[model samples]
Target: MSYYSISAILTSAQKVPCTFDLPIPNRGFLDDNPGGDIAAHTPLPLPLYLAELLAVQQLDNRPLLTLDLPSSLQPRVLNALKADAKSVDLRGQEVYFFEGAARVLELLEEEEVGDGLCEAFKKRAAEIADHARNARGGTSSGEGGEFLRGLDEWERGLFRAAHDSSKAVRMWMGEVKGAK
Candidate 1:
């Protein structure tokens, strides 16, 4: 419903004067008003679509926090995005790759890899992530495919840990429910 309304507003804005007097509703008594304006009409209707688009533009223009991600991680993310592009929109693909790259940085930070080792690890992780994001969709993994393979191995380890964690939580919940 909101999507349709947004689409309608965008379409409407593209045509005609692109302006409308949308009502502003407020809950207050008509009398005893602070500004003496009608209680239900204290505010004014603003340009809806233009305002929305401007807000979205501002969000998209913000700098990414993954700027410091390792060079190695960047390639791995790229490879993964490329591989998954067929199943995702451009923006979604970009977001997935960016998120994966950030995750690599987080792992390194948490592990507290020393400066020299950290630089090396970061470089390797960035490369791997970027390559994964850039990998060909429905095509064979290219020459740098091993980097992606390493990422796959890393994810598998995380998956195992997550699976165990979920199982433990589920069992704990079951025990609590039985107690009740």
Candidate 2:
């Protein structure tokens, strides 16, 4: 097994559809392009949920708000976070969403650690959704939809982080690997 570790700071989180941003390093940015700089995103926050989505899609390398772990762990870490997305709920959701997001912070620690936990959470959420659908004969209205929409926005933030981070990660990983 490879000995790798990752660590990240939330950087930013705001209420009413909470959003968080993670900062990327310049070195990572420069890896992809000759003149690339992480500073370009300065003063602008990159969403964490969006970051995970991009990682899940493999549209980018790793998220900008990543740990200093081995390059190989990016996908694994991202998968873990995506798996956690399933835990979202519409009823009294934001409160739970915050908790759920916080819980995944450990997964953000690295690509490999606590990966399956996310899968389990997501699986359970899906089952609950299925059960609700069966009971209601369809989806509910009002609060639930609103909450789900909020969740989507949160996910978009993650996607944003992941996409931005991916660029930096990919660039850096490529250079480091090439040099090796």
Candidate 3:
């Protein structure tokens, strides 16, 4: 649902003039409210589609609202980005795009597919966690850092080869689950 909601909302929408007022119940009001507004509900001039997107974005507890939008939205969003290609700072759009991809990868990983690739991904992730723990969170110029850096490069190549045949699931669990 979030996937479709985000895709639909992200589409280049045309703004139309207000035609109706949506009355929403405004509970937990204070006594010192405006004298002119005494009704228990408020009439907002928001379109229904916008209302639903905002509602889901707020209510959905996923880390980044992880869900792949329809394929159409991918190109639509890409074209939108191209039009506004001055910078990669389409704040909200970037978040949705990235999160949607992550969600897709997560779903693919969950399927009963590509056990070898999964194993390779897990092995690389474990090595990074156990052996290269100190390689992150600081500078990487010391001797120990160089050793860890070598390990990282080897792991990257290993992952690339392991996932070469699997286009659907190219990302490791470490990259998907652990942002750091």
Candidate 4:
């Protein structure tokens, strides 16, 4: 996806009501686009939930995105992730929400290095909320939300890196004929 699209997604994501109460970061300002700036969104610090939501959006928008994957990687790797690809049959069309989700979870697995994101997310999410508050010059009411947030830069980077593959996003598009 283009940088601009990322910005747009984030902007819309704010409306999605993340389980975590972390505030949405601004889209930034650019001279060219006075209304809003996509480039200004750089150095972006996206919370895990927001990123997942964006990943979901990206997945749902593409019907044929899965076709780009190497046919060899289909069943051996994608299906190995364990869930069946039933978007079209079930969700009406090829909505890759689940596939993108699987890949993002895979990222957490790799980055946490078996430490497991569950514990880390519970601990770090609060810290991230603190960091975001500090950056915004806003005050925290000492209230926390239900869902977790707050992945550090390294953690956030890993979460994002995994989603870089459309292959991962569309893993459920339907396994390759002979890919086992």
TM-scores of the candidates are 0.23, 0.23, 0.19, 0.20
Tens-place lDDT digits, model 1, residues 27-92: 123234444433322232223333333223422455111123333334553454445422222222
lDDT of 3: 0.35
Compare candidates 2 and 4 on TM-score and give the better one.
Answer: 2
**lDDT of model 3 at residue 129?**
43
Rank order (by TM-score, best first):
1, 2, 4, 3
lDDT of 2 by residue, 1-180 (tens): 112311122312221121212334444332353544544233322244444432234214534343222222235534644655443332233323333344344435543344443464455445434433333422357644443443433343443454456557667889999999
List of clashing residue pairs for candidate 4:
125-149
Off by over 4 Å in 3: 1-102, 105-117, 135-180
Model 2 misplaced regions, further than 4 Å = 1-120, 135-137, 142-147, 150-180
Which candidate leads in lDDT?
Answer: 2
RMSD of each: 20.5, 20.2, 16.5, 22.2
If the candidates were sorted by their lDDT against the true structure, best first, what order would they fall in? 2, 1, 3, 4
Cα deviation in Å at residue 102, candidate 2?
A: 15
Better of 3 and 4 by lDDT: 3
C-alpha lDDT (0 to 100) for residue 45 of candidate 3: 29
- List model 3 lDDT by residue over 19-111, tens digit each: 112222332132234333323233332333343343345223432122233342345544543453322222333324332333333434434
Residue 171 displacement (Å), model 3 = 34
Alpha carbon lDDT of each predicted model: 0.36, 0.39, 0.35, 0.32
Model 4 C-alpha lDDT per residue in residues 26-52, reported as the tens digit of each score: 333312334553431233334434445
Backbone clash total, candidate 2? 15
